[model samples]
Target: MTDVVSYPKGDLRRMLSVLAALESMPEATLVKLVAKTGLDKKTVSNLIIQAGEQAGVQISKSGPIYKLENWGPVIKRSGAKMALTGALNAPIVLA
Candidate 1:
């Protein structure tokens, strides 16, 4: 048997992007897309779970696959108010 290795640093923002990308793809391709993040597999997996929770998204894992649940509504509401008000076009930063 070989010892397992893990990624030391994880970026939640990157994980969120990965989740958004996966939302439009088939479940079977999750692992492949996550791998492209260049994070250790286990690290990426855990980050996915944590990010999902923070965003009020549900996630499940079976064997090597991870799935998101009810993420659409959560994503839709995230910036809806800002979008409607054209906040995205304004140059504003939170302090």
Candidate 2:
């Protein structure tokens, strides 16, 4: 079985960046997210889907545009933005 605990820190940061971008940008597309997060197209796409499914964020797409519908039950907008903005300032450890 794959080890969830061994997920890379870079990936975590990338995921957070993607979520942060969506939180800040109302009309974000895959391309915009990639540019904002410094991640590639495929990586952004995968992370966006992962964010929607695991992070409890509702993301809807119309044509080529993506929108953040609402902050779902699992994660809050301010909290995520805070973490991304270095308010937490602590290493993230997954156990």
Candidate 3:
């Protein structure tokens, strides 16, 4: 089985950068993202999907233009420091 713990940090960081770049230019295309991020087209595509899973963000495409939905910076918190485990779909109740 593929180890969920083994998720690549490099791809995460690259996607975060793509998220950042998308902020300034909200109407960029897939090809334009490759040039803007200096990441391969396939790599960018994969990162976009991963970003959706890890965070509650989405990248949508209309024709050739792409845009971000519920977009923001990805803040990585370690298990020890985090208040709760599992996806954010659960309630975030504080003690």
Candidate 4:
């Protein structure tokens, strides 16, 4: 399933890195993405939307909470998911 959608090329690694972390947690928040992935809040927020759009799902934000429902469909179709897998294995500094 993750073999379908193509992830953004080049510098989207940071975005993919964020998504990779989110993938492990059942629920997430903008603050969590920022804290966990070391991405700024505004950057994580924007990147999440961009990542979701590229992955074929809308990453919904509820105040500080964020989530992607049925993310399996979106993720399985995303090349970013693969990159995310790799990103998860790589060392990432937490904010």
Candidate 5:
């Protein structure tokens, strides 16, 4: 996905990083997202919102845990994982 699009950099990259992290686990908390992406709480929070609104990623929150139900409009689950894998030059893991 990202290989086909050169636009996913900077904040977009960060958002993808967030998505990648979320995709790696069944559910994650804000602290876990911050830890996994090395992003602050606010940034992770905003990215999650952006992913849900703009990208159509279905992220359901239950208390502090966030679960990624759909990969959203930008890409599919496998594509997002592969894209982030290429972007980081490593596999994305949150657990």
Candidate 6:
């Protein structure tokens, strides 16, 4: 049996950027964002799924649109420290 290594949490800026981009274009798929964000497809996909669950963001597999449902608290806490320096409005782009 091979040992499985756990990856660190993804950059939230990348997540939010992807989400923001998704807001404008909901038909973008995880694969597309993976290439756009320069993150591994699996990592980006998992982060997107996690964000959906934590922020109540609904993502349709058939389409690229994602709706943020009650995401105030989740977005606030989703790895903001590294991306934002004690501020939410900072323009930090995660890769």
Which numbered prediction scores highest in lDDT against the true structure? 5
Model 3 alpha-carbon drift over 4 Å, by segment: 1-11, 72-95
Q: Residue 14 in model 4: shift from native, Å? A: 1.4
Candidate structures ordered by TM-score, highest first: 2, 5, 3, 4, 6, 1
Q: Model 3: per-residue lDDT, tens digit, 57-91?
A: 77777898878766535544332123133253433
- Residues 2-42, model 6: lDDT tens digits: 22112235545656655654554545666666555566677
lDDT of 4 by residue, 1-95 (tens): 22222334346667666666676566687666666766567777677777767766556667766666545454552676655555446433222
Q: Count the backbone clashes (under 3 Å) in each candidate.
A: 0, 0, 0, 3, 0, 4
* Residue runs of model 2 more than 4 Å from their true location after superposition: 1-11, 91-95
Positional deviation of residue 28's Cα in model 3 after best superposition, in angstroms: 0.7
TM-scores of all candidate predictions against the true structure? 0.49, 0.75, 0.60, 0.57, 0.72, 0.53
Clashing pairs in 1: none
Residue 39 in candidate 3 has what lDDT? 70
lDDT values, one for every candidate: 0.52, 0.71, 0.59, 0.61, 0.73, 0.55
For every candidate, C-alpha RMSD to the true structure in Å: 9.6, 7.3, 11.3, 8.2, 7.2, 8.4
The digit string of per-residue lDDT tens for model 1 on 1-95 reads 22221222442344544565455455635567555444456766666666666666766667756666666445553563344234657322211
Off by over 4 Å in 4: 1-10, 70-95
Q: Please give, for residues 1-95, the per-residue lDDT of candidate 5 as tens digits.
A: 12222232353667877877887777699988877777779988988998888889999999998998888677677666566656546434432
Q: Model 2, 1-95: lDDT tens per residue?
A: 32222225455666777777776787788878877766679888988888888878788999988887877898777777666555778454443
Better of 1 and 6 by lDDT: 6
Model 3 lDDT on a 0 to 1 scale: 0.59
Per-residue lDDT of 60 in model 5:
90
Instruction: Tell me the lDDT of candidate 5.
Output: 0.73
Residue-level error in angstroms, candidate 1, position 25: 2.7
Model 5 clash pairs are none
Looking at model 5, residue 57 earns an lDDT score of 90
